[model samples]
Target: MTKLTRTLALSIFALAAGTAGAMPRPMDAGRVIMSDTADRDVAIDTSTRWVNVTNGQTVRFDVGGQRFTFVFDAWPSTDSVPLSAIAPKGVTVPDVRVYIAPNPLYQD
Candidate 1:
């Protein structure tokens, strides 16, 4: 089931992006702030896992056993969504927000 879930997730998300000609910057990446509540804390370590998704596009992420899906509403002024807002019918997931920054981008 994990293998199948991984395969399905990989096929659904467009993960490859070119950063060759990007403007002079220390780093270009986005962070997914996960939580069970609306409040978020700043990370002491300046790094995060990143993903490149088109503006206004809906994205799905299968983390652990939870399925999180949300729309990248083009760099929102406040980019955070609660599980209640994104859940399908009775299904629920964690909170997720994506934006630029440097953070630990690790795969588990």
Candidate 2:
């Protein structure tokens, strides 16, 4: 191939790769609320619209007019561990979990 053709092809390839690796712009505030209240490490992946937390990383959130806390326990198999929360009675919790595909969301 000619040098010009090769350069154009390389440029296109690089642009495509960059676009593929680019992360989506998160439309919401996303963060991992880590609470070390025990010997656990929780990593809450809320960008996916679910509170998928890991061991020990607990996310504290406020729903309605009350506050709620989600805790992830360490147990068998450590792949994609889920999290749970304790909510007060008669309160509606919003879906605070947000998953911006292509990459994990972050807050500034």
Candidate 3:
């Protein structure tokens, strides 16, 4: 194989292997909620739409230029929550579902 071709193959292999970690799914506001799964397509980018949180922990994520913090008071929930539950009184977040950590499959 040519040197450039071999390097390109290796780079592609490395990129695929590195992104095998679980990624959260995205949902539009007012849309029906679907079961959360890590085996989603690579094309969908939900990086900013979700937040991973731990038991009794607080997680903060940004949408646009604003920051929002969510305290997992109701941790151990099997479902996601709306931004209104965590957002400040007047700031309106986008139509997205926020999920906490402990993705179940990773739990004991």
Model number with the top TM-score: 3
Candidate 1: stretches off by over 4 Å: 1-48, 75-97, 100-108
Number of clashes recorded per candidate: 5, 12, 1
Q: Higher lDDT: candidate 1 or 2?
A: 2
For candidate 3, write residues 1-108 as lDDT tens digits.
999999999999999997885232222212222223222211112344554444344455445555544444443433466555555556566655555455445567
Candidate 3, clashing residue pairs? 53-101
Sort all candidates by lDDT, best to worst. 3, 2, 1
**Model 1 over residues 1-108: C-alpha lDDT tens digits?**
699998987766634323433332211222333433322222211233433444444455554445545444423333333333434445443343344222123213
**What TM-score would candidate 2 get against the native?**
0.29
Which should have the higher TM-score, number 1 or number 2? 2
Cα TM-score per model: 0.28, 0.29, 0.39
The local distance difference test score of each candidate is 0.39, 0.41, 0.48
